[model samples]
Target: MMVKQERAARTRQALIRAAAEVFTEEGFALASLATISRRAGVSRGALHFHFDNKKVLADAVERQAADVVARMTGEAEAAGDALDALVAATHALMSRLASDIVVRAGFELCGGPTRNTGAALRWQWQVWVEGTLDRAEREGLLAEGVSSARVAPAIVAATVGFEVLGARDPEWLSEERVARFWELMLPRLVAVAR
Candidate 1:
C-alpha cells in the first residue's frame, strides 16, 4: 500500500509540473490536459485520476508555487530584522522565479490575459511586502523620510515587473539586476545606524 501511495504521489507531482510548464508557455486558456499529460508521459486516464481538469491541475501548480513563496518569505523572516527579511525575500524571489517553472507559472496565471483566476500570487506578495515594511516602520528601521505606505506599492510594482519581464528575458531576474535595484533603493530605505 505504501508503494502504491508513493507512486500516486509521484504521478500527481509529475502532472502538476507538466501542467505548470504548459500553462507558462501557452497561457491558461490555450493549455490542454492532453498536452500536459503527454508532456508528463502519462496516460489520459492517469491524468484524470490525479486531476479533474486543467483548472484543477493549474490550482495544484499554483498551490505548490504559493507554498514555495510562503516558505521563502517565512525563512527570510529569520534572516535578521524586517528590512533584512525584505531584502532576503526579494533576492530569493527573483532567483526562484528564474529557476522554478511552477513559481513563474503561478505569477503568470495571476494576471494572464487568457485567465480569470484573480491576482492571488501578486496580492500575496504585495501583502507580505506591506507587512514587512510596516514592521520596519514600527521598529525604527526605516529612513526618517521613508513612509511604508508610500514605498510598499512601489516595491511591489517593481518586483512584479521583474517577474513579468523575467518571463521573456532572464536577465531581468538576475542577481546582479536585483542587487542593482537594492543598491539604489536600500540607501534611501534603510535608516542609518547611529
Candidate 2:
C-alpha cells in the first residue's frame, strides 16, 4: 500500500511537471494531454487516473504556480521597506520566470481565455502588489505624488509585459532587464525623503 501510494504521488508530480512544460511552450489551448502524458513518461491511463481532463491538469499547474509565487514573494515581506520588498519580489519572480518552467506556465495559464478560474493569477498578483504599495505609502516609501493606485497598474502591466516578451526572447526575463526597469522607475517612485 505504501509503495502504491508513493508511486501515485510521483505520477501526479510528473504529470504536473510535464503539463507545465507543455503549457509554457504551447499555451493552454494548444497543449495536448497526450503530449503532456508522453512528456511525463506515463501511460495515458495514468494521466487520466490522476487528472480527469486538460483543464484539471492546468488547474493543478496553476495551483502549483501560485504556491511557487507565494514562496517567491513571501521573502520580500521580510524587508524593512515595503517598496524595496516589492522590487525584490519582482526581481525574484522575474528570475524564476526565466529559469523555472512551472512559474512561466502558471503566469501564462492565469491569462488563458479558456479557463474560467476565478481571480486569475495575474489579478492576484496585481492585488498583492497594490496592497504592498499601499503599505509602502503608509510607510512613506512612495514619492509625494505617487499613489499605490497609480503605480499598481503600471507595475502589473510591466511585469506581465516581461512575461509575454520573455516568451519570444528569454532575455526579457533576465535579472538585468528587470533591474533596468526598477532603476528607471524607482527614482520616480521613491519618496523625496527616501
Candidate 3:
C-alpha cells in the first residue's frame, strides 16, 4: 500500500510537471491533456487518475506555485523588520517569477480559464503585503498617516508590473533596472523617518 501511494504521488508530480511545460509553451487555452501525458510519458488513465480535467490540472499547478510563494513570503515575514521583510519577499517573488517557466505559466493561467486560482493567489499576496504594512505601522516603522490597505496594492501592482515587463523583455530588465524601480518606488510608499 505504501509503494502504491508513493507511485501515485510520483505520477501526480510527473503530470503536474508535464502540464506545466505544455502550459508554459502553449498557454492554458492551447494546452491539452494528451500533450501533457505524452510529455510526462504517462498514460491517459494515469493522468486522469490524478486530475479529473484540464482545469483541475491547472488548479493543481497554481496551488503548488502558490505554496512556493507562500513559503518564501512567510520566511520574509519572519525576518526582523516588516519593511525589510516586504522588500525581501517582493524581490524573491519577482526573481523566482522571472526565471521560472512553470511560475510564469501559472501567472498566465490566472487570467485564463483558471482565473479564480490566479485571483486567489493574488489575494493571498496582497493580504501578506497588507499584513506587513500593518505590522510596520504598529512598530512605528511607517509614517503616522500611512494606511496599510493603500500601500499594499501599490506595492503589489509595482512588483507585478515589473514581472509583466520582465516577461516581455528579459534583456531590458536587468538587476540594475529592478533595483532602480525599487529605489524610486519604495520611498513613495514607505514612511520617511524623521
Candidate 4:
C-alpha cells in the first residue's frame, strides 16, 4: 500500500511537470492532455486518475507555482524591513519566472481566455505586493511623497509586463533586468532618514 501511494504521488508530480511544460510552450488553449500524458510518460488511465481534465492539470500547475511563490514571499515577510522584503520578493519572482516553467505556466494560465480558474495567481501576487507596500508605508519605510496606492499598481504592472515580455525574450525576466528596475525604483520609493 505504501509503495502504491508513493507511485501515485510520483505520477501526480510527473503530470504537473508535464502539464507545466506543455502549457508554457503551447499555452492553455493549445495544450492537449494527450501531449501532456505523453510527456509525462504516463498512460491515459494514469493521467485521468490524477487529473480529470486539462483544466484540472493546469490548476495543479498553478497550485504548484503558488506553493513556490508562497514559500518565497513567506521568507520575505520574515525580514526586518518590509520595503526591502518586497523588493527581494519581486527579484525572486523574476528569477523564478526565468527558471521555472511551472511558474511561467501559472501566470499564463491565469491570463488565458479559455477557462476561469476562479482565482488568478497573478491577482493573488498583486494583492500580496500591494499589502506589502501598505505595510511598508505603515512602518514608515516609504518616502514622504510615495503612496502605496500609487506605487502598487505600477509595480504590479511592471512585473506583469516583464512576465509577458519574457515570453518573447528570456532577457526580460533575468535577475539583472529586475535589479535595474529596482535600482531606479528604490531611490524613489524608499525613505531617506532625516
Candidate 5:
C-alpha cells in the first residue's frame, strides 16, 4: 500500500510539473493533456486519475507556485522592517520567476477560463502585499493613515508589470533595473510627512 501511494504521489507531481512547462511554453489554448502526459512519461489513465482535466492540472500548478510565494513572503516578514522586507520578497520572487519555468507557465495560464485559479494567485499576492503594508504601518515606516487596502493593489500591479517586462526582454530588464524600479516607485506611495 505504501509503495503504491508513493508511486501515485510521484506520478501526480510529474504531471503537474510537465503541465506547467507545456502551459508556459504553449499557453492554455494550445497545451493539451496528451502532450502533458507524454512529457511526464505517465499513462493517460494516471493523469486522469490525478486530475480531472487541464483546468484541475492548472489549479494544482498555481497552488504549488502560490505555496512558494507564501514561503518567501514569510521569510521577508521575519527579516525585519517593511520596506526592506518587501524589497527582499520582490527580489526572491523575481529570482524564482526568472528561473522556474513552471511558475512562468502558471502565470501564462492565469488568463484562461479558470477564474478560481486566477483568483487564487491574485489573492495570494494581495494578501502578501497587505501584510507587508500593515507591518510597515505598525512599525511607523508608513505615513499615518496609509491603508494597506489602498496600496496593496498598486504594489501588486507594479510587481506584475515588472514580471511582464522581464518576460518580454529579460536581457534589457536585468535584476539591477528591476530592483531599482521598485525602490524608486515605492517611495512615491509612502505617506508624506506634514
Candidate 6:
C-alpha cells in the first residue's frame, strides 16, 4: 500500500511537469491531454485518474509554481533591507525562469489569453513587490520623489517583462541582464545608502 501511494505521488508530479511543458510550448488552448500523457509516458487512464482535465493539471502546475514564488518572496521579506531583498528576489526569479520549465510555464500561464481565467502567480508576485516597496518607503530607502504606489507597477511590469522576454531568448533571464536593469532603475527608485 505504501509503495502504491508513493507511485501515485510520483505519477501525479510527472503529469504536472509534462503539462507545464506542453502548456508552455503550445499555450493552454492548443495543449492536449494526449500529448501530455505521452510526454509523461503514462497511460490515458492513468492521467485521467490523476487529473480529470487539462485545466486541473494546469492549475496544479500554477499552484506549485506559486509556492516557489512565495518561498522566494518570503525569504526576501526576511532581509534587513527591502531594496537589497528585492534585488535578490529578482535575480532568484530570473534564475528560476531560466532553469525551471515549470516556473516559466506557470508565469506564462498566469496571463495567458486562452486561459482567461486567473493570474494567481503574477498577482502574488505583484503583491509581494508592492509590499516590499512599501517597506522600503517606510525605511526611507526610496528617493525623494518616488513613492511605492508609483514605483510598484513599474517594478512588477519590468520583472514580468523579463519572464516574457526570457521565454524567447534566455539572455533576458541572465543575471547580468537583471543586474543591468537594477543598476539603471534602482538609482532612480532609491536614495543614496547611508
Index of the highest-lDDT prediction: 1
TM-score of 2: 0.93
Instruction: For model 4, give the 10-residue run with minimal summed lDDT.
Output: 112-121
Clashing pairs in 1: none
Give the worst 10-residue stretch by lDDT in candidate 3. Answer: 111-120
Residue pairs clashing, model 2: none
State the local distance difference test value for candidate 3.
0.78
C-alpha lDDT score of every prediction, in listed order:
0.92, 0.88, 0.78, 0.89, 0.77, 0.91
Give the alpha carbon lDDT tens digit for every residue of 90-148 in model 6: 99999999998889889888888877657888889899999999999999999998999
Candidate 5: lDDT of 120?
A: 64
Local accuracy of candidate 2 as per-residue lDDT tens digits, 1-194? 99999999999999999999998888888999999999999999999999999999998988998988888678888865798789999888888888888878887887777777764777778878999999998888888889999998999999889988997798998999999999999999998877
Give the per-residue lDDT of model 5 (tens digit) for 1-194: 99999999999989989998888777777889999999999989999999999888888898788788788888987897787788888888788778877666666566456444555665677677888888777766775556777777888887777666666666423679767877786666566652
Superposition error at 106 for model 6 (Å): 0.8
User: Best by TM-score, which number?
Assistant: 1
Which 10-residue window in model 5 sums to the lowest lDDT? 110-119
In candidate 2, how many Å is residue 108 off? Answer: 1.2
Residues 1-194 of candidate 4 have per-residue lDDT tens digits of 99999999999999999999998888889988999999999999999998899878888899899989999898888875788788889888888888998988888888887868754788889989999999999988899989999999999999889988997799998888999999999999988982
My TM-score estimates for the predictions, one after another, are 0.97, 0.93, 0.87, 0.95, 0.84, 0.95
The local distance difference test score of model 6 is 0.91
Give the C-alpha miss distance for residue 25 in model 6, angstroms: 1.5
State which candidate, 4 or 6, has the greater lDDT: 6
The reply for model 6, stretches above 4 Å from the true place, is none
> Which pairs of residues have clashing backbones in candidate 6?
none
Q: Using lDDT as the measure, what is the rank order of every candidate, best first?
A: 1, 6, 4, 2, 3, 5
